[model samples]
Target: MIIEEIYQSYLNFLKEFTAFKSISTDPAFATDIANTARWLQDQLAANGFKTEFITGYDNPLVVGSYIVDPKLKTILIYGHYDVQPPYAKASEGQARMIEEDLWKAEGWENDPFVLTEKNGRLVARGAVDNKGQIALHLTTVFELIKQKKLNYNIKFLIEGNEETGSPNLRHFIEDHADLLSCDSVLISDGEIASGHPVIEVGFRGVINTAITLTTSDRDLHSGLYGGSVPNAARELMKLIEKLYQGTTTIAIDDFYDDVIAPTKEELKNHASFPFSIEHHHRVTGTKKLFSENSLDFYTQTGLRPSIEITGFESGYNGVGFKNAVPHTASAKLNIRIVPNQDPKKTVKQFEAFVKNNTPSYATVTLQLGQGCKPIRINPKSELATKAAKLLTQEFNKKVLYKYCAATIPIVIDFKEILGVSQVLLPFGNEDCNMHGANENFEIDLIKKDIGVAWGLLS
Candidate 1:
């Protein structure tokens, strides 16, 4: 009854937060974005935090501080209020009209913004990816405040554009270093591996690229020019084949030059992970896994450089069929890099590799997006051990340590910019479906995370 009451009250605030529909990437949602930031400032200010707004950026930032002493240690909490929009096809992604139409047509039968309990999970769009997790942190702080036992200096950096690559955070941090400086930074933007408490120690870097090949000006009939002409689709596939043609290792020059292999201790720790290839298959909905024989799922995912064809398009793909070879074909590759790998250098190397592999008949071009560097910390450190112990005691389960296989660019920025160690302490379940439809957060996991936060002060 006590926890249910606490959660019930918290759910009311979460409902208010989620109702904003704050999708930052679309300018049409600009008003919603601004209102969300303003709403957050009001909520934190009401909760006894000194909240202010920082400007001169793509999106305004909300900074809330609860400083009890200058002598006590300080911790910085970072989170985003942005939620991704409904999914869209790549072609329709850039055009707002098309995306909007699709969003409206989807009918959203369930009302995504409303907070409801389904099988004990709190459901909403931004519920777990950040908003719910961050809300739980606030709830914990409020609980401590109610007992008149709150201490330490807390700075909450809640941004509105993290889903849009955090376009202004680096500059804001650089400009206000004195105000934001702290001993440790806490991030709950990730999730638990299975059902255990994880003090994530590392995450892979990323470089998303698109390579396009043009063989002719227009689509050619396969029946007439099938053998005489070089099919753009075939040429593109040939170049893609060379990227990881025969082996699991990528074929780009200097791609792995800066990659750091897992240490012996790290490997020993990885062996104990609750990873299952079968479970992976079930979650991913794939019948087979690549390089399963040569690499463990954790090793291949967390420690090595890998390439994924996130999307590919070549010839005609219609309901019936088209009997022509398309003039242009493109493949989107998202390379997941490791620690020490420079995304700029990797892109240069990838460009050269793409050029050298293209045939004479086809001309190739590359489009590269932003890159994120990897980050690593010791899970056995004093702060991590204390947090782990608190979580284990609260959950009554063995705590887990993991290297996040995905990329969190801001973690690298926290280290490189603030010169402070950062820890990813997730408060959501693995099946929260972050960035996907029907995303939700587990209330019990949030309680465990709150316990960790309480331990930090104790």
Candidate 2:
């Protein structure tokens, strides 16, 4: 009956939390982001948490401490308060976003900011990626306190720059190690895999690579000098072609030097999971799945490195294409690295490759964006067992202990700064559309996760 009792209150809290445009990447929402932190500080303080703000960054870090006994093992809850820029700024190298951003994105079941009940799911921005999961923790803690059942000390390090690649996270965690230190960390920021509960062992590391080629000072008439002048877009395309010789391989030297191969046990576990190749294609909207050694879908997703072109900005793309040879062409790429690969080192290799391949007639520059190293917790660790048991029991289904291909960006920082055993307990559905338009979460899963949080922590 705890789920029933907390139902309406849960909805109300999420409703207010989702309304804020706390986009960490946009300085325009700086005030709104500050307000969001204040709101969380107040809420955590109200729940008996000793809260403080770590300011002076693009987004502030909210630290809340709640201690019950000196001898109790303290567990840190890590989550983000910031979100992806809701609306897109096309002029600033953004794809024109639909709606008021996600709110009006087509095919949405309901308003993204206003929680709408569609079947047993709640549709909203930040509904499941992070905000929904954070709400589950808060509610569980609130109930635990009310019932006098808190079993362990809790230290919450809620950040606001995760969506923008957690630019200041390493600095923040290193500075406030004493405040956020804990015996173990529990993060609810992944998707439930295999139609059941999942214990994610690792998330892939990421490095955003940008390539810009300038062939002229300004746009030149394609008709007048099309044959004589070099096309910036063509020059960049040639570089990309050299980067990816095939669909699944990066031609850059030393790209795979640091990749850690999975253990025999890990491979056997992945093979045991009920993964469907067809279903994987359907969910991802891809024509085919690719990996280095023709690994299974799950393994290919989480265990390998990937080079994805996220954005390619160049040329005349407005109404009625102006016949002009583009002078400046740029490409945005995300290189997803697996365990043991150093993100900076990998970027260096990529830089070397680009430098070596640039045509003499064209000038090229490489800009490295945000990147994080991948992290993996031993699936058989005691902490993993404890969290996995609670999650499986809550869902009444088999749990998959797996690796995620995408990077969380914060977990590595947690390990470096807090030096705690990290466990990923994913409560969000796999098809939640997190970070995409029409994001949503199953209300039942949220409630179940709250109950599981209570069972495990309390």
Please give the range of 10 consecutive residues that has the lowest summed lDDT in model 2: 86-95
Q: Could you tell me the lDDT of residue 310 within candidate 2?
A: 77
The TM-score that candidate 2 achieves is 0.94
Error of 1 at 48 (Å): 2.3
Measured by TM-score, the strongest candidate is: 2
lDDT, residue 259, candidate 2: 81
Give per-residue CA lDDT, model 1, range 1-458, as digits (tens). Answer: 43454466578878899888888868888899899999999988988898889878778899999887889888888888888875544342334555445544544325667766787788778888788988877766666666666666888888887776675678788888888899888888787775777888889888888889999999999899888898888888888988984557898877777888778887788778787777777666688767634666667788888898977888866455789978999998889988788888888898889888888888998888777777787677556677787888887777777888887667877888899877678878888878776678877776566667766664
How well is each residue in 135-201 modelled by candidate 2, as lDDT tens digits? 8888788878888899989888888988878887788777778877788888888788757888888
Where is model 2 more than 4 Å wrong at Cα? 91-111
Clashes of 2: 1
Tell me each candidate's TM-score. Answer: 0.88, 0.94
Instruction: Flag clash pairs in model 1.
Output: none
The segments of candidate 1 whose C-alpha lies over 4 angstroms from its true place after superposition are 89-111, 220-228, 314-324, 380-382, 455-458
